[model samples]
Target: MYKKSKIALAIGLSVGLATTAGAAETNWRMATPWSGGPWLERDAQMFADHVNDLSGGEIEIEIFPGGTLGSALKVTNSVKSGVADISHNYINYDYGTDPTTALLAGHSSGLTPEEFMMWMYQGGGVELYEEYRRDMFDVVAFPCAILGTEIFLHSNKRVETLEDFQGLRLRTSGAWSELASRLGASTVVMSGGDIYSALERGVIDAAEWGSPEMNRPTGFQEVAQYVIVPGVHQSGGFLECQVNEEVWTGLSEDEQDNLRLAGKLSVFESWLASSYDDLDAYEELVSGENEIVHLDQDFIDTIYEETAKWEDEYAEDNEWFARVLESQRDFKETMSAWPEYRLPIGTMGR
Candidate 1:
């Protein structure tokens, strides 16, 4: 009877392998919201390389640069409906799909770049959507890339004070736009593609687009006279990885593990890489090639404090925001020990 049981178990395992073998190639299509510039191209390539390498060519994802397959909006929905196998986008782009999806997108909430990373990875924030983000979006939640922190105010007009934002036509997205409206600005929602023409043509006086390297591709240099620092609107933001559900489910346990590891590494890469870019951009902006204006440091301190208050108040109304904030704050506290352990040793080595 024991031998019979062993034989039955072996047969079941064999059948499972046979079923997986009969499954089709785990090929996928992947795209990002922004045009496939340096970071996007590198990230998409990393995903393809790692997945293909780990899967032994069983799973392949063809990279589509911006608008090649469809818009950023379409990409998210496409992945959801299994029209696409994977996606790289800001989850906040799908604010309509579910408010909670925006948690990692980093539109609001008083998260610094490191805090946001910690919150998403160690803070139990992503787990809140383990069902919807992991299942409904038909993908695993990989906090793949971070745009660093953004500074608000790329205005056609000078915004010296919060009151100066009143009646100013500005381009924004996510819950932060609502906060901008409350503060004074008339918010005009836009896709990333539309921002350039709108700002150039004076359709909008100001806009907030981060990622210093990415903005260079759009010729924001040509039109927008001023770029302010300390992005009050987006102190931090993130890019989400939405793996194709069927393709992911088909992956062996080892392959799934590699994909996740790859995602976390990608986020670290983004974090390290963008810090350099911001410094470089700031140097260029101040070189007088561009008419860059720095907001007063005092003003920045004020912005940070006020936004924190706004975030708490905003959380009061939105249950999702409240949960995200609490989760993120907890993550930050947990990581307080990390700086002591990691930074000092690294600096000594350097």
Candidate 2:
């Protein structure tokens, strides 16, 4: 009887250890800033799926969409406090802590979305960003989603020239808010979830979000009749995934490589996905009640000039901003000759 009891006890201990090991494998909780739309939601899901596949199911990331966990602006703090193991975030949202977040988030007017991504991947921007995240926020981050060129504004009133910005109550973020405020627009800071309600209630006259594809699902068109194109404020903005520093350090080197691969894959796939949606949405808006306004070239030039001036002023005061600006500008200059040298093959200058 004693021998039989000992064997059964040993078997129970083995089963308990197996169960605990399985439970320990899934170690991450990735939270999204907003209850994401299809485009954003797809990327998050893809990232999670890739990590799981790469780790052979040894690591699992559970996603919580929306401010379901907390406010978007508080994501950095949430990660720091380990309320979330990781988060899909926009560094620009945390500009209250460091104005340099605008530069890292790629808010400048000069580069195209693709060029901005190149800067991050090849032009030393990623190193600077990683250093900033570590030193300032004590978090680990990567440029996980490339939003590309965003729409300038969805406005209740048509905007054709610089003067149109005057006296309009607009919802904007980062340094663009300062520039817009200088141009006489009253800039209001609000989250994506709050934009429609704000517009519906006459609280804001205009708001700027990502590409039309990304914006259409938000139903901004139902509230605002005019769509401003050629996003001057957010030409090449992208989003980042931030992980708790402790959590990141605990990851295996192979797991780190897989995470980076997932980010790169999402960047390319997101642009491709959003392009189709944007074309379809653009056609629908033009064919329907909303009017698309292409800001005139001369007015666009003025915006470019204003943005240049803003960059200089910000760089002068913030050392972090200055370093990033200098690096991006250098990369931009190096790549300037390529487009001119390569002949346009399809739809060039159209």
**In terms of lDDT, which candidate is strongest?**
2
Candidate 1 local lDDT, residue 227: 75
Question: What lDDT tens digits, residue by residue, belong to model 2 across residues 238-281?
Answer: 78888888888887665666667656666766666766777888
Model 1 C-alpha RMSD to native? 8.6
RMSD in angstroms between candidate 2 and the native structure over all alpha carbons: 9.2
- Once fitted onto the true fold, the runs of candidate 1 whose alpha carbons sit more than 4 angstroms away are 1-25, 135-138, 296-320, 332-350
Itemize residue pairs with steric clashes in candidate 1. 150-231, 151-231, 152-231
- Mind giving the per-residue lDDT tens digits that candidate 1 earns over 88-193? 7777777766555555677655567777776767766556645457645556657667766675767778776665666989898777676677767789998778
Model 2 Cα displacement at 189 (Å)? 1.6
For candidate 2, the lDDT comes to: 0.77
Question: Where is model 2 more than 4 Å wrong at Cα?
Answer: 1-24, 343-350
